[model samples]
Target: MIELNPLVELIIMNFAVGLIVTISLNIEVGYLRIPQFGRLLAVIVGAVIAAAVPGRILALYLGLPYGAEYADHMYNAKIVIQINNFLSKNLLLSLAVFILTLVLAALAGGVIGYLCAYPALRLKGSYLGITLLTFGEIVTSIAWNYQPLVGGTAGVYMVNPFAFVGSGSSSLAALITLTIAISIYIYAEILARSPFVRMLKAIRDSEVASEVYGKNIVKARAQTLVIGGAIAAVAGALWATYTGRMNVASYTRLTWTFWPWAFMMLGGVGNNLGILVGVLLFTLARTAIIQYKYVITSVIPIAAEWLEYILVGLVIIFVVMFKPQGLMPEKPTLTLPRKAIEEIRKRVEQEQGRL
Candidate 1:
């Protein structure tokens, strides 16, 4: 049986992580309306950053309560081994390395997504998604095979994220992480409900009509992709920190990007509140499944472990059959007022004239 405090701690932590991941994906599928397939690239980027930053210094800089947490991990033989495997015990260089890794990976991931937008110019929907998916697979494969990019199939052992940095162990990190998740969701919420988001909806609904009405479809998409991709990358950096390991196999299909898509789709694309609900439910259900794995294993006799696949497939089917528009479909978009339209035109002309 799981301890009450730890169980509560797990729920809080998973919920925080799930919300961040879901919101990042929402930015692509809902807000940007881009056919994004490699959003997981962003998750991986965040994970690496979070892991690489020396925990102790990071905890101080980020105001994490680190004292008790560090001692707990230090005393644990397994955790100590993980720490030694991934980081130099000396704090300064490790922290520097962490910062460097986070920035480089994020920028690289963003640049890759931005460049891919060019190919997207010639494709949309499933096709564009497939193309990005191919890239993601290739990257994941390389990571799995390469020794330095993180350990190979063995899966790099990671110290608790920023264990040295913060003071309160898992709960403290969970609280901080949840706070960041809430803030990001709030920002995403503002974007989702703003005139800016409605504009994306207009394009998604009918690009030709939007173009005829003087909306720059290209500019809107490019802006959304860049911002969404960058934010996703940040999320990835955070994940890396929290987990402290980066095996390519862990990022394979459905785990990083697709899982979030599942939540967003199940919840309803373009509906922020629905996405939040979906994430909570999904995390709880998955956690339950894990806790009862032994029961599941004994109850159902199978040649292999296909539970995860079955669960995912059932979810996809369930969403399709019962709620094609998702559990909470996005509300119909409304037209912007004529005055607002005129103001936009005026602003554009002034900016163009200045340029």
Candidate 2:
């Protein structure tokens, strides 16, 4: 087996997770124009579900302690080792556990999205954005203080389905995550070219006009949120699985929400390909700074920790001032068949020539 450089592995994992989350954000805020500031809500929902749910199911199957006891640090550590041993030997079971966790996470995330739609329907513009942001912060507070959900501040071990791969588990996990992220990117591209996305773009431009055209604005917004939420949750689940732990505190507004928005904005709002470009550039920049922060700080006057924030802020400001539309600005999707549009264009040109 070819060994991956540790740095390369880390970058790949970050890119995959960032891509998934940013694409989710693009679907809502970009195509649907849903000011989805509370993106972290569904992500936390996914991570919490991945953290708390799967192990219990496995415990029931194996006749081990679960629920409250499973949340205990000592019990969690001991039991997870046992589970990992079992999973490492039985590849099928490990795969099952992995799939089951993501499925549950996606479902719960979708439900949460549906619930958020109430506030979405009631509020608009910055008010709606603030409401969503508050919702995320509220969820974070609950998860941070609630022990049973994910062992609270202490955190909890996640069932590593990839443990079956032994020492190569990290590489396998990164590969799986990157594959899933790419799959979602392709799906998002197809979705962008779909009539549904066109409708979303219309509603985004003018809800009143969309409503006049018989689009159910409420239903559309709700559906968009549900889809975005489920996708984001999958990203969260993947992160939990990759790290083999559920640290609710790590799933913060800065990493999960704001970063994705910045990525989507920098990449180009409403452009999936542009999102890929943005995520790649931002992920590399962020990762490099983190990896060499101490080294860089030793030579510079700035604090190592704050360098990321300062650099990102400066970069965003530059982009906004010069490339306000993003590195790849949104382009109009073809609403008509290419051949038909060409024929019409030819007729119009001929008529103009006669005139």
Q: What's the CA RMSD for each of the models?
A: 7.9, 4.9
lDDT of 1 by residue, 119-197 (tens): 6678878888888787777766765665443445555445453444444545655566677779878998888778888
Clashing residue pair totals per candidate (backbone < 3 A): 26, 0
**Model 2, TM vs. native:** 0.93
Model 1 TM-score is 0.74
lDDT of 1: 0.67
True-structure RMSD for candidate 1: 7.9
What tens digits encode model 2's per-residue C-alpha lDDT throughout 158-268? 888988667888888999899999999999999999888899999988989999999998898889999999999999999998898888878889989988888888999
Q: For model 1, where is the 10-residue window of minimal lDDT?
A: 68-77
> Each model's TM-score?
0.74, 0.93
lDDT of each: 0.67, 0.90
Compare the candidates by lDDT and give the number of the best one: 2
Off by over 4 Å in 1: 1-4, 49-109, 151-161, 164-167, 302-305, 333-355
